[model samples]
Target: MHDFIDHNLLARLSALPLESRQAMIGSVAGKHRSPHRGSSVEFAEYRKYVPGDDTRRLDWKAFARSDRFYIKEFEADTNLRAYFVVDSSGSMNFASGETDTKIQYARRIAASLSYLLVKQGDAAGLSVCNDKIHLEIPPSRSASQLQHIFNSLGELEPKGETGLVEALHTVAEKIKQRALVVILSDLFCDPEELGDALQHLRYRKHDIAIFHLLDRQEIDFAFDRPHRFVDLEDNSTLVAEPNLIVDEYHAALNEYLTKVEAKAHDAQADYQRIVTDQDYEAILSDFLTNRLR
Candidate 1:
């Protein structure tokens, strides 16, 4: 048990397994649909019988009617391999008021999901990305893997500029097998660039889930008087009166958000915009429940 994991919350979520939205290819027999045919009870489809085909799988009744040998294929059940990519950029260190930092919020989400995934007999991995991907933990179903993921999450410190786009591209190329890529970040990079990265993952046939982490302050910009704003990614600062430029600021923010969301939709990724102020348990519950639907 780690600080990021709440035992009571884990108990509540234990019944809800983490499911994949698409068929997967795994090395074990478990839940979820797989592209490969196996001996599962669920019927898939019939195919023309070929040489070396298993005789036990032959449908004799179909052959008797059609005068051609056919083999019955049953849907294969496989486990899911999930990669949790957490953005460790300086912006992730931001928290408005008493709210948790973006990285802190992300840690809870990633750690909790990892626990559920492994507990349900799936595999889980971790990647912490800032200017570059700094850490990589390959997916594993071993029960002890949960502690490895938790330790990595607990030790993360947000710093440097974001290289999320590059990190995603790397993931798409590195993970030869299909997997569920769960990304948690503020997504400060260009939306178009991010779209290309996501498209790469889509092209590779990997399922993508993006949690666009944001602080309420970043969205509301509710400063009452003149304030000095600093860029967390860089050592840059700007002094401005909130009343004077609020409209322009909001316009820019709205445009950026729209583009990012549109890009996510274009890539067919499961996208969730999260405000750090919200309860993480509720957010994850909704996410897990929606997948069941």
Candidate 2:
């Protein structure tokens, strides 16, 4: 395993408050607000108290006027489960520079997210998948377990073909409880296959977020000289002058991205395209803000 540490990146992320840091994973039990209201100190609303209502929660003042039982409802504090589905396929290893590979950036994202969740006392687990799902860590609120996740992430390498649909189906089957599933991948696969996988996850009522990782050069067709572009997974190569095909490539990429976004929307999942050149914190913050809404 090749371990590359970016202390500067970690330091920058560690400085942010837990809530502000994990805003992308959506609100869990921590700083993020959830849709479900429960019995907490924070008053949510007043409801008619039935016979089985807890006597402590009864609002006597309200009951006195109405001559009926009423209870004050407060938000409930509950632990949340977060799962990261990281792709370890060959395509994820693509990098234009030595300092940052797609997989490397993904590890950082996973680590930061795990740190935020653990800090907030939420159960966080990791499932590393390639052509098949290899590792499965059941969600738990253990700092040591999170450390294990980071260690495992460091060991992962890009290999084999991309079988996104198959892996997602397996994940949907294993996770019995509804959880926030964050998929980090380049998404270099057939749209139909990817759609089917997402649908399966949605059918199971899992909150899904797709982090579409890509290189800026790939998106912009910014290759400077004639070169042979190779498909990492298939070992297929094509040599051409990029300028001749740049327009068509951008058009195709844009169309594909649009279709992916549409599919995610239809599945009721959050989808964000992340370019390698952008700042991770900003990307995460934007996603979190959307999640909070």
Candidate 3:
């Protein structure tokens, strides 16, 4: 019943399967190709195609060599644990355009991914944080568990300062096994602190992905007139003319973003910058497309 996730979006996204670059220890036998070889249609190796073999998978080149057909065999598929770590800091509530707030859009992403994973027989978990962890749900494959994830996401209201560093470290410790950790946030935390926390997850061997959400106004610096700029986290205000400080602000923000991107690369994390005006479906599709089987 939640608007964050709907049948239509789920139906469309179900085609896009999630994959991990390294092997995953799935809780149950699922569709993803496992690192270990087994019985699946993923084409791990080739075998001589026989008389009864389906022609669809036959290799004509192999047949031409010795007049014998070959069939490709695949490794076994397994499920993966997907952890959605969402930032509930006040900054994520900003929305300068008609599109939804960063937090709202993030919720849709977390919810949709959870639905997709669960529908594919994989497990999905939820973690909400702002200065501290507010809610935590361990990964689960049960379809009924999605209601819990949706309810948690729906209840999140972005407020207070961010403690993303503390959050990432805490969640990394909680997960007992390697998992796909996806972080959705505005990333307004200290850059060094952020890097350290993400590195902690990397040390644990968790596959990390960071979604850096920014509102259009933040990205463009398109403000025209003087106005009171209020800090959402602390409710602090400053009256300033946009034309005067836009250049300086852009320079500082870009420098900070560059550092974050470099840190992510150093840590081998998939870093994606998402603008609030962009469609979530397309963003997610691009991210998932790279790892699909």
Candidate 4:
């Protein structure tokens, strides 16, 4: 991770109005559609008149014009609900250089997104999880609530094995309404397990986006000197020469990432590979553009 300041990034992001940001995303995302329904001007389906139906829905203009009563119908407009799932596992605490830790990057991303959602009057919530959910905030459209979410994200300290699958399953069971589920994690776990968990969310009709966060050092195998690599989650250590294993390690890593991406696509979800070394704004802009498309 790089030494990018959170406040700086937040300030830059704040410049874009919430509606503009959402509209930018809306332009790219084929999944999101206008949710309005009415008979005023827009056309919707016509249903047989039932008792207790609103009389205003009746096409009185059509009836007087045609001598028959027909209900005008229009699509219903609805606000989007978004849930941000942050991985607080031990591996997310890793920072090999001047960059912030993965956890820090994840928090900034979560905060920016939550800010956007709440600003647009959409419901947004946060969930921090390791092996299980450590904190859960229900969806809300309050600025104060968003501040609390930012505070909670800022205070988090990562420490524990990843139970990504378990945590997601728990969340899937808890949320009753459909929502957009955004996952921010390093994703150092079994691919099959992760896929299964994501499938569960998709099955419930939730839109999903996976942000696979990682350090550039981890991806490029840039460690020059021989060193002991430690697995933060299991506390296991292994001595290795990067020059000797770099090629094999990268091959395996790429294969794993490919599998994850393929699975997400199959499940009708968006998958983005985010490097903590890059500018956060660029990554977010790309994501929104892709979403709107």
Instruction: Give the root-mean-square deviation of each candidate in angstroms.
Output: 2.0, 3.9, 5.1, 5.5
The clash count for each model shown is 0, 3, 5, 19
Put down candidate 3 lDDT per residue, 35-128, tens digits, no spaces.
6766575567888767887777787877788687788667877789999999999998999969899999999888988888888778999988
- Backbone clashes (count) for model 4: 19
lDDT of every predicted structure (CA atoms): 0.94, 0.77, 0.86, 0.77
Q: Which of 2 and 3 is ahead in TM-score?
A: 3
Clashing pairs in 2: 23-288, 24-288, 38-76
Off by over 4 Å in 2: 1-37, 42-46, 60-67
lDDT score for residue 120 of model 4: 63
Cα-based TM-score, every candidate: 0.93, 0.84, 0.86, 0.81
Q: What is the lDDT, from 0 to 100, of the residue 141 in candidate 3? A: 89
Using lDDT, give the best candidate's number.
1
Model 3 TM-score, all chains together: 0.86
Candidate 1, 1-293: lDDT as tens digits: 56778989999999998899999999988898899988899899999999999999999999899999999999899989999999999999999899999999999999999999999999999999999999999999998898889999999989999999999999999999999999999999999999999999999999899999999999999999999999999868999999999999999999999999999999899999999999999999999999983
Best by TM-score: 1
Q: Which scores better on lDDT, 1 or 4? A: 1
Candidate 4's C-alpha runs over 4 A off are 1-73
Tens-place lDDT digits, model 4, residues 115-211: 7777666777999988788899988877888877887887888988997889889888888766788999998888888888889988876788889
